[model samples]
Target chain A: MTEIKTETDPSGLVYVIGTEEEGMSWIGKESTPVEEPYAIEIRLIEHFAEGIEDPNPLYWSDEYAQQTRWASRIAPWGVIVLCKEHKVWRPEWMEDSGGQDTFFCSTPLPGNKLLATDYEVECYVPLKPGDNVFINEKIIDIKPKTFSLGEGHHITVENYFRNQNGDLCIKDSRTVFRYR
Target chain B: MQLPEIKDTYYEDVEVGDEIPEISIGPLSHTQFLFIASSHHDWYPGHHDVEYAREQGLPDIFMNATWQHALFQRVLCAWAGPNAIPRRIKYRMGKPIVRFDIVKARGVVTGKRIEKDECLVDLDIWLDKQDVDKVTKGSATVVLPSKG
Candidate 1:
């Protein structure tokens, strides 16, 4: 009997498995919409506070929140962050043949690092208990890049968080990865 | 009910190149990671479960992105007044955040602009700890009301 050894071939790497055009087509592939309510009885905000070890009064105490500038109890930022992850659509097709995700890189970033040249988060309203949040997530932008991580499509997933009344509460956008 | 006093940074008060006061947190713990995973309903075992973390090529459960973002928000509010409304927070995760790493949230005011009545503070932020190369880095924007 002979023993055979296996090694990963790093040569001739397929940086972009799909054409730029095909990747562009993925920019608006699908949208995920979900509704969530922040319930007071559950002390949802308190859980977040505990998780982060932050005891901001605005997150749990109505009396303190009423005295704050907003003058009302508001959800912790963590709650909203979890909502973003909750509604994000990570399709199965993005996985490579190796079963490794094409989106996450072995190295997160390369070189001197890019200046956070841009960032925008808009909150039209603060989340409160009994208020329902409507989240509509979509891939809004896609671009080709030969930057630090590697040659791949820079995909931006944007989420619009609206209140039950349809008012925008938060606009969060994160750029994820997809390699060829 | 008396609210915590808010001493806002007005448009005239900040200038480009000013470093926002830095806030330090951590010595990342497994318990914290598990707490966050549970809170977010992110049952991803690698983040908190030790065995799962080892299988994922990590020494142990580490700080996940969600909790890191939550920490960023805490750092942001450290200097921002009650009136400061966070508009954006963009971070590029650099490396695995392991246990007992004391990460520091350091930010600097990069640009300030006036759009109508709003004063927007543009900042370059980075999170790193002793012996740990920067694990997360990005920029943030906030809308602060100007003194009338």
Candidate 2:
């Protein structure tokens, strides 16, 4: 397997995955685990519920959640990804790099434009308030495909979320169509 | 905000071809989009900047992936009941859900089975824009409590 290298030029950041053979090398290469900046909190959970206008008692009301199996307020299943999103605020010295740089985004391909075409998520445990989360991301697969938009590759990336105790909480995967 | 009554759904009570009550949310406005974007902490330009989206060949700003997933969660869990556990959710994105598009999330029971002493239900789920075009479509697997 070829080791793809990342390079930066005056034009900006450039990641070279090389040929298809080189791109294949990225499969199974996992990134170091990164802990979420903040622990899960009821306020944050309710804020997300409000954003989506979801009135599910499980996400907000402590009394209603207490009656459920969890016996405590829990974050919505969909909010699992949001909990691991890149921190919005960064140090002033840090450059605004658009968003968190992941192997999937930096991997060089024929197409520069990207679109998320598919997603899959499996919840192992309910994300409860006060649980600290850590995430490990890896490239699962890369395949050549032609779409109506243009020719590109279908990249599948999987994200594994775990609690501070190392118990897996959610396994999420997304397939993006990168086309010219 | 008032909490809508969500009936508890049991595995024994569900049957193949039963439709989950659809949830409609849309004619989405800029404020709503910003709220979601901010909450998710997604600073992706295509999700918030109209000019950036146009530069990327999109007509206007659109919902992010996380927001799309949340739409399905809202509908499925509400119908499955509070005790139900969402084991898996998968969907394919079709047309871009841009601003002002009225999107509706829906699901139907496709099958059911018992695994590891847990009752699991399979559902085909989708999101439609204006009750016409499907902007997102896929399937989900959930664990529901049994009456027994």
Candidate 3:
């Protein structure tokens, strides 16, 4: 396979084009919402803690989690964001208008907290090692907005997390961008 | 808890195509979710709201792509250990990850080279089910401990 190089910014920042925004515009414009599901494993928890500079005992301490309300080691929100395999290809129907340099540009400028950049998490039950879970995702809504950088758009993608037993865990809304 | 102990090694010690140790994670509960949620302070009931998710045309609430991407990087974190600082990591959101999902994340040393003090290790990271191909795969560059 050919190596795809990341783009570099003038300020020496690098952009990893993990998610090729191909058919995203279609989902943003003409397509109906889409959904997908995945299985989770113990490794995910370890990754979660590594992301946010947190290595607290509770995360790995089974006894600690059992004693606490959490009842088990949980992952960090940053880990969730980072866990996504960004290089996954966009749907065949989706076309790429362009891409973003995530390193230098914070496309969704950190404001409005949840509203500006929507986030959601649900704990159906505490997860422990040796158990399997599932994740279901949907491209629910898309909205276009024009900012100082000309015409741009935002995507409202939703996700549902559950265990093999079919219990609900979490639902999330992610915003993707297309800016000039 | 402390990160798993990994021995230090130069890039020369790492051979291409070597499989880094796989890591296990999760089985989170409400309080665990709250701890993560409280830090970022970014939560939408739709993520946790079953009724809302169904209303929005989803089966149930799932994890965010960003979080999943971060979780996947732990494979690299374990391999690179303390000497390595993650320079780049990227993954795409294919499916939603519900609570209790057993996420199997791993890494392979795809490329390695030395640059003065920084011994670079290029790895291909993956997150998958116990018996599946791969859900997410991406490349990562880590600055490993130097031989010098």
Candidate 4:
């Protein structure tokens, strides 16, 4: 087994550097389920809606939402992506350590720069407040190619977000270009 | 903020070539970018720090993929009304949207079908910057209620 090398940037984002062979080896690998630190809240949903200037009453007024098929103030479908927990405050134990490890950032790929090129999402059900959300991600594809930025690979990761009852809420696939 | 009175778009009322009402987002400034970044919990420096973005070869701090996705949803839902449900969305980023770039979301109905007793409409959607550059392009599937 080759030793895996990693680098952390000033923002605490981790990058993996390895040979093409090592990169190919990452396909089909799945990350453990990561649950959001807290249950979905109405305030968080409103905050996201406000940021986008979306005034859909379904995402705002509980009274209005109660009259709809959803029966409650449900979040916008796009909020599924925001439900993932990214550590902003370092934990006491890791106060001096780099950022928390995420599957995409820790993939064994040779890249100093990363850009999201494509995004696809399918929603099965609406996420509501008090629902506990969790995600499980898998590396589905890796294609090495030369691009305008430089020589690199396009890695596609598929993420599954489910609610507390294990009902899948969203299936998202993101393609990111990792270049030099 | 006052919510707009929107008319719901029923599947029976849509035609194959009907265009959704276009909505413009910005000439985005740092304030908007910061709000979006913090709301999404994406603390990527390239999205907020101009110096870091320039160092990383970006023209300037720009909007992230998730923000663009939300913009698409906002346009779709705004046109289709609260009853419509977004089934799927697939988009590809074309150009980086930096500060002072106004993005407009537009869509045209391409097809419609009934699957599992649900009325589904397919549309081609995109985000254009400054009415010239197509900053992002994609397709989406939405479920709209039937007048029947």
Candidate 5:
């Protein structure tokens, strides 16, 4: 076992490497817009609501959403949390350490934590039904460290949201791990 | 919605290898997404668009990992009934759970032990997407009131 030391980061770590220098080339670059739009139709949105066991009428009722000044039936917050697109790329060292199968390989902290240390979100505009939205992501920073469990590092990534009308919806800053 | 009744489960009543009832969830609708996005204020477009998802090189708009973790509690609560508190849940990302996707939570009783008045039911749980393999898997330990 490798003896590790904790860095000055708020969360102590046993291992650490900076990802910004290695992976920040794509930062601020917009990905090519998709040719075929990923349709988030009303019916599909309704189905997603039911799947998550969400009971709010605004997400299922157009009339309710319209009354509330929302653009359309809204997507679930959990959907964004579950999304896999533009996720932080794992560093080569981290991947080499465990390869494919491993236990507790990664822990991506929610960007919402940046807004509030306790993991809460700040609402700007509600995504309504039929509202077309786009997501853009970038790796902003990285910090390596050693923890009691062993050696690990933290990676922070930023994401931006834009609606069809090109409105800034949300900005997210999230953190993840690359452990040894 | 009224809370489900708390089922009285005893350590003696549960055994290793017993399977929990399977649950089917979803057809996640746009409105549901809106309500969820608005409530959680997530407002991320990749969550509601496949175009954005493809741009990001993903199969579809994926579910938020953290939100899924939180909602998993509801699934556990439903199965364990009201009295059980979700102690700790950990998961890694798999495939994105999309709209109209029906997911199920199943568990095998891994072990059971008694701690005074508390009957601990150790379960190995999985949140699997219907018609597909498992999306996320983890272990949970719930403390149920014992039948003393």
Candidate 6:
């Protein structure tokens, strides 16, 4: 058992290779826009609202939504957080690194002290159930910085969600402190 | 605990410095976190597996960052009306929101303008910790119809 040793990143091995590079090597990288078609029978947005237990009449009844500016049922803006994900290509390393924990084109910190430094999401066309959103993500910027958590990289990920008809539905930018 | 049902805050009435409506949620349950983990791709074992989390040095299962926005979405639509076309939402994540912690989603109107006969409202939004700190911080923009 003495000869047995655990493998390590000897060169301080960057585990999540191509997707995450040293010093802005990945600055211009863009993922193939992921599109997932939503079927009519599923009421995803409403169910998301229900999951949070929000008692909004607009989410519950089309009758109520029509009374407002919207002439039909509309979803709570944040409900889109739970919308079905637009599929994206995952590097084999990422697939094996446990799961999606905000790695977004940067090196992971030593531990789970990551912080949500900042984020931005915008909507152009109102989202409803059965609406297929095509998501395009771009890596805008990454900077090495110091924070309460320790040393980490600050990264910004911008996303644009376009409906099947091609209208921009929602846009979001999330900044994360991937720290040690 | 709850607000009046679906009251419309029209563009003409809203103003800068006014508080963007908010929703409070929390002390999330294990089952709920489990439900979210199962439904979405947020499959980090640390979120559900106590042993894994302990080995990785976490106290217990914790809520993911996405849920903070869920509360924000509820608060915004509750005030501006669901049809209010949202223009943008940006956020900064802070503390780990775990089970049994109450979080309040709050925001304040930062700006407003009129263009193309539509009124646009800009808000600075956040999810507040039980004390003076914030869990997540951000901004949201929405377009509201004119009273006319």
Which one is best on DockQ? 4
Q: Chain A TM-score for each candidate, in the given order? A: 0.59, 0.80, 0.51, 0.89, 0.54, 0.68
lDDT of each: 0.62, 0.81, 0.49, 0.84, 0.50, 0.64
In terms of DockQ, which candidate is stronger, 4 or 6? 4
lDDT of 4 at B47: 86
TM-score of chain A of 2: 0.80
TM-score of 4: 0.93
Residue-wise C-alpha lDDT for candidate 1, range A145-168, written one tens digit per residue: 664444555666666878778888
lDDT of 6 at B19: 87
Superposed by TM-score, candidate 3 places the C-alpha of residue B117 at a distance from the truth, in angstroms, of: 5.3
Which regions of candidate 4 deviate over 4 angstroms? A91-100, B1-6
For candidate 2, the per-residue lDDT at A113 reads 59
User: Could you tell me the C-alpha RMSD of candidate 3 in Å?
Assistant: 18.2
Answer with 3 or 4, whichever has the higher TM-score: 4
Q: A1-180 in candidate 5: lDDT tens per residue?
A: 953322322211122223335334333433332211343456655655555675555556655555433434555434443232222245565533322111111123211111111112222454455556666555555455454323444555555656677776545555554443
Error of 5 at B148 (Å): 1.7
Question: At residue A89, what lDDT does model 2 achieve?
Answer: 57
Regions of candidate 5 where Cα sits further than 4 Å from its true position: A1-51, A54-180, B1-6, B115-117
Q: What is the lDDT of residue A53 in candidate 4?
A: 82
Q: What digit string (tens of lDDT, one per residue) describes model 1 on residues B1-148? A: 6556546667678889988877776777767776776678655455667875675456776676667677777676667765567777777777667778788878889999988667889888888887775678888887876776
Q: In each prediction, how many residue pairs overlap at the backbone (N, C-alpha, C within less than 3 A)?
A: 5, 0, 69, 1, 48, 19
User: Measured with DockQ on alpha carbons, how good is candidate 1?
Assistant: 0.27
Clashes of 4: 1
What's the CA error at residue B23 for candidate 5, in Å? 1.6
Q: What does candidate 1 score on TM?
A: 0.72
Per-chain TM-score of candidate 6, chain B: 0.84
- Tens digits of per-residue lDDT for model 6, A89-178: 456655343222223523332323444557666666676666666767777888877764477677777777777788877777777665
lDDT of 6 at A79: 49
| Winner of 1 and 2 under TM-score | 2
Highest-scoring model, TM-score: 4
Number of the candidate with higher TM-score, 1 or 5: 1
- Fraction of the real A/B interface contacts present in each candidate? 0.43, 0.71, 0.04, 0.68, 0.06, 0.57
